[model samples]
Target: MIRLSRCAWPGERGAAAGVRRPKAAYNRGMSRNGRIIVAMSGGVDSSVAACLLKEQGYECIGVFLRVGAAPAAATDESGTQSCEVPAAADAGAAPRPRLRHGCCSATDAIDARAVAGRLGIRFYALNFEADFERIIDYFVDEYAAARTPNPCVMCNVHLKFGKLLRYADAMDAEFIATGHYARIRRDAAGNATLARARNLAKDQSYVLFGVQRSALPRCVFPLGEFEDKRHVRALAAGLGLRVHDKPDSQEICFVPDNDYKELLRRRRPEALRAGDIRDTSGRVVGRHEGVANFTIGQRRSLGIALGRPVYVTSLNVVSNTVTIGERDDLLAGGLVAQRVNWLTDPPARGCDVATDIKIRHMHTPAAGRIRRRDDEAVEVRFDEPQSAVTPGQAAVFYQGEDCLGGGWIQEAR
Candidate 1:
């Protein structure tokens, strides 16, 4: 059974504190449109999303996913400050509270509850800690295998859209909405197509490539039509929402201290064994700590100096070695992706589908041609060689602003 914790407002003390309410309490006094569950993260973007949906006559139920452990103290109204220490911090110095900039913390949950109360909406904090741990395990496993993983993309695929959709169904809700800066446009035949938001700079279509195609019609993105974050904040401020100036979540929620290496050290120390750092010609230039400490295209803290700069070109888990080479070695003309997911119809095997490919979240979509290798795999040939085609990162495909599909990078060829 799915675990959940209901957040009650001040006026709902009686029912929320222990008084039982009827199951149909949520359905009574509904708005003109159907109910929509907003994934409120206690930020300006999600706050405005809830406000807009309410104004559009939809019964908005605000929900927050409690992903992390509760902090020692609650956060301020802005949800920007937190008291926490890094796992690798110096023990001699007085423990100072570091600025917590990640989402789904205790402070974030409180902020989300406050927003829901302000809007007079039914609020629920679902305990997703158990589900989130799986993502953390996936991160450790990927790094242990010498590959970089995108946990946010996987979170969207598995939790936000995956588990949350199930919750929506249980609640008898019509749609699940979020603050993601991506759009879904339906054609004349009611076929939903995912596209980039009006704000290209904040477009999050890359991370959303794994959303199940069938769920597109039921998904809603309120911030998709806005020009930028400024407008969203303004809307929140106008609505009297206290989180108008809240800072955007920066680091991974699970890695509050921004020290993934320390986390790996604790969780998978055996994977970080000492290994040989080899040059392109298989010559051991120096010794290193572990392959997990490095990623493709990284140049700093290499622990060896050959009087010339070198980048991590590849990692071998079987041999426990890190390969370094010139900058040119990081560029790749093609990549093979596994577990491919297509929002549109699957391209025929051996037929090249010309499209733009994004190797990483921040990467510019480069011109490329993707050909289906099998039912679950595809090969992408870049029009021009791209840099740092790291394995385990997503390779999202797009045609213009419409996101066609994507898959996890298996290897850069």
Candidate 2:
């Protein structure tokens, strides 16, 4: 039922900017005859997303995104172990080439098809290989180069929330929906703001911090209000989606088998060269396989012996050095962030707006104040020094559950 060739579509996959929005038909709290396109990932969350939209009376279509640049032939054999879903049964099952993990492989597409069949909706698989290379491949490269890269944030900005929104426009759909555990609500001013999901443990608003301000109104996250995974699984099982019991994918989507270093070696071997592990005094305490293999505050992989435990303080990609220091040295009073996107208008200069700042996805939000700097970056001064303020990671801002927007951390002061 699918083409065997690599190239299919002649044009780019994402939606073109400046396209006019289609007329929306739904009234508040009522079903709309408007069409909705839900991104189905062959998992319970998204599978239930499609079902919920249809239940709400929206004309629904299910889409599976095909990503990664490796030839489908190569991935056919190798992809099953890492794929979140089972491989689609095709004639060439024996030659199942291992595909790099975390993308739409043969299995995810097939599982998505089954869900669509159950829902009685139109299903289509669109290839987004080139975009994935640009967004995810470069992400891994940066990390291997000793810089922390947030691929999920990049995917949300460029692929899922960005490109998918565009595709919905081309299909004349009123809105694009996903299974992410984040909520979108319009405030009293009619401003679309991202909010933490009801399920705090599974809240994914941090990764979605980079969603463009203009695209906020056209997006929907059905799983945001469902606080528990058990309820979602129960709903899925009740709805008869085969992915009801499928384990949630916890690895980076483009990474093969969740091995970041292995993916780096396959793509860019030069990045894996050994580098010096230095201390605060610049003394070479030891040698490391690569600076990229370490991250800020990482203590497990130093392979160096200090009288007391030491932590990774910094990774200087230019010098190819990993700096280790005492854990106390990792604390910082502030950080400088680039590519800042504010959901509301930019705050005034020197404005001490009290907010919560999250340096990484799992880190608890810290009280902080954001001040605009001239170089298109924001200076975030934490009320208390936070640990492991890693560069190249995102520092997302929030006002309670509302997403105020965020920026990429360039440095932690």
All candidates' lDDT scores?
0.79, 0.75
Which sections of candidate 2 miss by over 4 Å? 1-33, 69-103
Largest lDDT belongs to which candidate?
A: 1
User: Model 2 reaches what TM-score against the true structure?
Assistant: 0.84
Which model scores highest in TM-score? 1
Per-residue accuracy of model 2 over 21-112 as CA lDDT, tens digit each:
22222222432437887998877789877776776667787877778433332222212211233335432123234344453656667777
| Ten residues in sequence with the least summed lDDT for candidate 2 | 3-12
lDDT of 2 at 340: 94
Question: TM-scores for all candidates?
Answer: 0.85, 0.84
Residues 115-171 of candidate 1 have per-residue lDDT tens digits of 676667877767677789999999999999999999999999998999989888777
Q: In model 1, where do residues sit more than 4 Å from their true spots?
A: 1-33, 70-99
Q: What is the lDDT of residue 1 in candidate 2?
A: 36
